[model samples]
Target: MDSGIGSQPLQEETADLKAPIAEPSINLDNRIPGLDDPYEHALKPNGDPWAILLKPEMETDKIQCDAWKEEVQTLLIFAGLFSAVVTAFVIESYKFLQPDPNDAIVRLLTQIANGSNATSSPASTSFTATAPSLRINIFWFISLILSLATVLVGTIALQWLREHQAYPACSPKQTLALLRMRSESLEAWHIPQVFAALPLLLQSALVLFLAGLIDFTLPLGPKISIPIACIIGLILVFLACTTILPSFQPLFLLSGRFSRDSVPSPCAFKSPQSQL
Candidate 1:
């Protein structure tokens, strides 16, 4: 055998061995299309869940804190102003608690002048505060105290809100967990209930003041007292309706809409008359 003919079979075998082999005709993708990458990615576990879950929780905490802070601040301002006004009224009303010497001297002088001009003796004056004055002072003093108390409550609420917003230095995950815990504590302690009662306290003080004012004015006769009473009663009615009717919501719109009204929303069920 010459080299050419003898090497032909070997050359053919070499050519066969050199042929390109098919790669992975049956691969992971072949078994199930497009599932392998997700399985691998899931096993790796990225930071997406941390951001996605915690972000809303943190934002919810912030929104609640800001809303309460603003409301408390506004209530504080009203309480301060109301206290000042009530204090001014108290300053005048309290003087009636004790007999004023200056007032007595003036009354004496007036009686002396009247006695000299007329033949009759000047009638003895009662320097002591009458029942109406005592009642008036009591009501006004209570109102002033209540207003101050409201201010105190509002201040405490502000502090609570501030403390609620505060967080320890920590990682984001820890921070969010801490916030949730604090919020639960806040509710558990009835901080929201305390906040809810603040307005009611303030309103009670105002009602007491008005009651005292009405009592003080009643001596002026029906001409003065009737109109004053009517006006005050009207205001009280309006305020009461406004406060109570909001609780009824879609059931009672006569008091107008509130923060949680369904004024714009259509009724879910049509009436039989409407269907007709």
Candidate 2:
């Protein structure tokens, strides 16, 4: 009887407390009311996702994206210059791949003179490739090709970045929503990752060129080639050290990345914010 009385008070307390209401679920498919007809931004050809952005986040992301774009431009510039330099080397190196007619004639003459007294026939005047020449030419050609490819990819990436900056919005109030959509789209499509890879391609081209240069100098005697080889070796070691330093110390890679101005937090995130 005592237990039943205690349980009756607990049941009464439970009945007095009202059930908690559920939070409304987000509905992305529904068109936002009072906005212009271009509400379905995600489905359009130049689609931007419907964005819910905090103003501060939008501003900060803009700064980071802008900095990243500038970096790509700089990379393109360097790639162009490097490609020209590689082309110059390529022009010189490619000639060695083919047999020189003058050299064939010289060999013929030397053979005829040496066989003047012998009754045996002279050797055939066919060209043969030397190991060092073949290796150097192959290395340099690949390097030149890689550098040119970098320039080409850089150009395409820059164009994509340019096209992405514009937001598709019919009304001025929808500006913030559109901006956030475009920013999200950029990240979703992996544009930043593309920018990151450009440097790696350029670096590969540089390494190949250095290897080819080493092969080219090695043919000369120890007196001349030794000094050149040592200097190049030192350069390779320095580049390797600098490249690896970033893995050990990440701050070195991220230094000076931020812009001088602070990113202003204009407002908090809202679906279709009034002002962009």
In candidate 1 the C-alpha lDDT for residue 170 amounts to 72
* Span of ten consecutive residues with least summed lDDT in model 1: 267-276
TM-score of each predicted structure versus truth: 0.65, 0.62
Predicted candidate 1 versus true structure: per-residue lDDT over 51-116, tens digit per residue: 567789988888877877787788789889888888888888788788776865676677677666
- The parts of candidate 2 lying over 4 Å away from their true place are 1-58, 107-124, 246-276
Candidate 2: give the clashing pairs.
Answer: 176-276
Task: Please write out the lDDT profile of model 2 over residues 1-276, one tens digit for every residue.
Answer: 999989998998797786676889787767556645555335556434434234566578778768767877887888888888888888887778777868756766776786663444445566777888889888888888888887888889878866766566454347676666877887899877777777777877888888888788876778777887898889878666665544444353348554558652322322111111
Q: List the residue pairs that clash in candidate 1.
A: none
lDDT of each: 0.76, 0.71
- Candidate 1 vs. true structure, TM-score: 0.65
